[model samples]
Target: MKRSYLLIALIILSACSDSADDSNREIDTVILNDLIQHSTEFEKKVYSFENGLHIAVGYGIANSIMVEGVDGNIIIDASDSVAEAEEVYSYFSTINSNPIKAIIYTHNHGDHTFGAAYYYNLEVEKPMVIAHESTSQYVERIMGILNPIISKRSTRMFGTDLPSEQVINVGIGPYLGVAQSPIGYIKPTLTFADELKINISGVEIELYHAPGETNDQLFVWLPNQKALMPGDNIYRTFPNLYTIRGTPHRDVKSWVKSLDQMRALKPEYLLPSHTKPLTGDAVMETLTIYRDAIQYVHDQTIRLMNEGYTADEISHLIELPTEVSNSPFVREFYGTIRWSVKSIFNGYLGWFDGNVSNLDPLPSEEYARRLVTLSGSEEKLFLALEEAVQEKDMQWALQLSDSLLALNYKIDSTNKLRQEAIQYIGGRSLNPNKRNYFLSSANELNRNYEAQPLLPQTSELLREISIDMFFEILSVRLNPKKAKGITQRVCFLFDSGETRTITMRNQIAEISSTNKNCDIQVKTSEQTLKESLAGVRNPVLSVASGEIDTGGQRTKFLSFLSNFTE
Candidate 1:
């Protein structure tokens, strides 16, 4: 049953690429030769194992698995948000009435962890939220300082603004048709560093740190059920060795080791975070292919890097080994080989591509102006770009368009041509991430500006941050120009009996737990303090409302608070 369904899924995978046309494909030099053979396959909606162990696939971009434990049910890898998580909860509720005892997060990705509160709210008493210890570090960084910028990038990556006809599935699943919501997450009560075994409702679950997609990534293993959940380690598509949305270079060496550990388990069932579950030979075969494909790319990239090949050169030279590349499971539906090759090169060798000219290259605008002067006219550049597009040479077209766009002269014709060219190239991209970037870039060109104020003023995750994190976040918002010669120390006295002294000097805010006599001392609740820092509450209003009490110089306190504004 598993084998038959998997075969059908592969077929569906190939059929989904029908939108990609020959001309579009030819123009995009980033695309590799079509190595994935088409098959008429459909993904299984759900998989049922013995003893009511069920895997719900395609709830969102990822999969959620339910285990019928002796006392209560346990869910692994919660779906994207409350809506999706509610659906998973409702589906399993029809099968079993047992209350959920625990929720295991594979990692801290919003898609996998945000739905936690949905399941948490389902039970009379909350279930335990479990994950690796480093989960909090990623959570704080992503939801804090990086939130605004990353959110905007995600808007592009998900094609949030594009119409239905223009945007397609996000590789692993259909478009996640929802806005960012933080209401569904319940903080983890339990965390582990390495291997940890625990019995939840008579189910023996073993978690092993498998750092691939994320540093905090871990896989769940069921000894009795013989089921293995590798999270995002082995999705159906070619593993996203590098996500263009911008991420620290993934540790390929450790990632390969994690896969080898999973291979040794030889579990009877394979349930990954994204895509369908597999059983028997299907499990072993899929794992082997995925492991080899990652290793092949990793090893070859390192070998070529040793030979002093630049990132661009390596990208052109490296191709997936024929056997590994030909595997139906290793297709570039979500993550492609070209992006991975560049990521690998960057990971091993720093950004410099071993060229001195690139070390101190002219600024993009200067370079563009120079290129136009050399070409003699903006019209000449446009003609060249049009010719490149006509010739189905994406590289030349984009290069020419970039130079044209960089010129101070905003040629309406040139801008339209570049936007059209990018849209054309993006439409034919097999990798969803690549497609999203291309289409989003084109959409931006049409609008004549990039998206701005990318982050929300405040978020639930921000609200849940600690006092230390609060000040740490505040310190980054400091404006050096505003405080050029000013220096002051402010003491915060919380209603909860906590005190922190913040020293501001040299345009930096240094937070310490110890209190001291300072230029200003303010007393308020942590929540009120955060609201003030977020600029949602005015300091003057807070003082008038008695939500805050000031000590020392009243004028000095107001002056200190004024320096810190949105």
Candidate 2:
């Protein structure tokens, strides 16, 4: 009777403690909204540059700049979101009643293009939307490719999940807002081939292809007026490299070259995509510093690669000198140099360290499970994990939990860990992208504990990725030495008889092959294919596991596969 009473008392105490904890956990909804609110609440400045030439800055969501050319008035890169765009329209109405002749989007990034719709949604017929040809090739494909990934990263960077907070700012100024992108965005209608010179209100705004932030970047240069628009390409901050919202690695070389191109333009005053509008010879100097800062990342990465430094080592070892890292223009607002350096290394050298020990690696979860076995007893392992968590070593805590959950069933320690880890990581404010993953993982683990669902398998995870992320996954499959000659040709075929072929040449994965009679046939609907490539699994994996005939054309197809360092 005594032992039973003791057990009952313990259960009651646990319940009481949980209730007390829940009561104290305030939502702070007001603060969350305020974070979203003040994030982009800054002064919008209107400056008259030259004769009838003027530009508007300080827009929430996306940067708004009005160019009063000779033809009429042209708006370049309308703000990203809806409410922000309308405010811009209101700002323009206050300035002048001049009809908008055209709206040119510098690139395909949602921010620069989406704002075009708001004015059209109003009484005005939508001004012709302009962009580079590459941007318009297939708007659906690009969105299908990047919408989830970029928005996810952007959401994390901007703290789109929660309301928003001062600590979670993604831009330098208080102007850039944070939030998830709505489902639909305005697609560019008109596009340029290479370069085009159009007179917007007699203001000669030369639209040239300067692929900086995105592949289809359009830079507007007022040659006669000595003014320029670099869009998101030449932000006042360090170029966002390896954004937390996931995408393929950006080419640091191309990025730097674009900045150099901007520097050569020698514009007196410039309105970039983010931060404040910069003017004077000081603008050029700032641009130069920004250019050299990116170059530092690229050059150091290559040098380390030549010396055969591993990606992890390169990420930790490479650092921008004080001249670059600490520069006002190089602050990590959108992206960090550390992640960028890692990206450069990952882009060139691939993931492997050329070591045989890491050649045939088990999946992360499976490896974690085995580790728990090696360490012995659940209680002892839990103690180590608690210590790591207490020390604020989130990295180690996460790694330890990986195997802990992998190893045991119905362990109280795992449940405690799930609850504690979530609280711990949820409190820390790191990079938006990293925070999301950490928090999401905590959520996932919590849900798993609440229900004790079976852990996911590596194969289950890989087969569900999309075309964009498949390259990253494929890179991981290669050994360092075999990675040298592994170029690949991926031809995506849709039932509509339309086909898109991607040729990944040079650098890592130097070999190539297509799905037409290649190794590893992936026969599925376009959506399924997309889901798989995006690193988000599709239902087809279940069918594959259940021995279902879901594997259509590519079920048993095999492509020539090899690894190479280009």
Candidate 3:
């Protein structure tokens, strides 16, 4: 039966249970049952194909594929952590046992690359690590300046802190396993810009850059086997055009073009990094519909944009044609049409939306105060929030609570109501991304909920990150108030024969390679500096131990570093 029809039946069944106890609120059984069914996509097993390709799915957030070569095997996209990779390799060992000759990263996502170290260090001779030329830099950005916020958002989206029963699946995978072990990322040894064709152990492999879900995404084509590996680009679930966790604007048009490039290959077998594989004519059929769906959304959004309709208006007006929506490939399992519409509008026209009101909107606090006054009084606003919850209008209740929180009235009562609204809406959501995010947000409202640190602190992972990224992180971490009216220049001389200077002026830190004049110069190895800055080592102790020399200006150097502390 079509999944959409099944969803309609589930929605009907959910209505019958609306009167279930609210005190013991749980995810709607109908939606929970559907998500439980979806978990089958990641069933733990080694699926071997006729072309000598084996994929280990449900072992981690990504599928790790192994292609049997003449004397050795090639691995495509490692699992999320050392623990998951080791487990996957154990399964691969039973099938081939041939030493892995190469590990190819489809993109820079941690789920695809973090567990690479296990595969790379398995044999006496390390396997060649290959990726797009820009992959390493993108990895650095994630592990560097964007680490804190991305990690926080990703944690919520994945429901990593939620109890196992509360998480059915993560849309694309069963669960993210990075927290199972330290990150196992190893830098790529061989990189390419557009395409790379190589022969490993008598098996010919061709990789092409196909940017879609991620800019560094690549698709693997094996002419000998007539098999294609399209990485995250063509997962079973809808593509995450704009992840709520936050991302740079994804180029929707380029995504369509990338799908077209894949269709041109006409492979007999399709092996995606998520979900199960497809063989025969189904491969072509799936590719065609997926690309068409993406193009349809892109074109329709642009058409309405030209009509002077705002993004909000376009989102409400646009709906996928029944033909496109019925395709199992385009379901709102991950990305929804509504979110995609706004992202596409923002990508091309930016946030203005051709509306003057939004261009210079009142501050959120001021707006909240006005809303409270319009409601007749703060008490009336609180009563309205209570009424919304009583009416089961959870969305409205959540919004009303926002104003109450903003006014700093009924702090404890407002939070309790807000939590109930989010939990209710989250429990009924069929989309896992929205479900997990809402539930995670609800959990945060608990009085005793404590957040765990999510940054990569292991030295092994730190070594894979570039030293220059540390300076980039420092520049963003500069405390404007502390740096105000401060003029100073600090120079770093790494033992690897590279020098960098940081100039602090006008409440900003500017980094330069050429060190003309320096007030204080510190000499150390890049590794030492990276470790010190990551808090793996105490800088004061390193300086005292003579590992980091500041030309006897230890106090000044320490003071200089303090300005960048948040």
Question: How does each model score on TM-score?
Answer: 0.87, 0.68, 0.95
lDDT, candidate 1, 231-315, per-residue tens: 9888878888888777778887788899899989888898888877788998988888888998888888888888888777877
**Candidates' lDDT values, in order?**
0.75, 0.58, 0.86
Provide the lowest-lDDT 10-residue window in model 2: 451-460
- Mind giving the per-residue lDDT tens digits that candidate 3 earns over 1-566? 00222343343343223555744334366456666677788888788997799998888889999999999999999989888899999888988898999999999999999899999888898999999999999999989999999988988888787655566678888888887888899999999989999999899999999999999999999999999999988978778888998888988898989889988989989989998888999999999888888888889999999999999999899888888778888888788888999999999988898998988999877888998778788899999999998888999999899878988989999999898888778777888899889888988999999877655578898999998899999999999999999999989999999999999999999999867789998899988889888999998898888788999999998888899886
In model 3, which regions exceed 4 Å deviation?
1-27
Report the error of model 3 at residue 362, Å.
1.1
Poorest stretch of ten by lDDT in candidate 3 = 1-10
Clashes of 1: 8
List the candidate 2 regions with Cα displacement exceeding 4 Å. 1-58, 122-126, 137-139, 145-153, 165-167, 172-184, 408-566
lDDT for each residue of candidate 2 in 105-128, tens digit (9 for 90 to 100): 887666666556565455455667
| Top TM-score model | 3
Native-to-model Cα distance after best TM-score fit, residue 129 in candidate 3, in Å = 0.6
Model 3 local distance difference test score: 0.86
Arranged by TM-score with the best first, the candidates are 3, 1, 2
Q: RMSD in angstroms, candidate 1? A: 5.2
Cα displacement (angstroms), candidate 3, residue 5, comes to 24
- By lDDT, the best candidate is 3
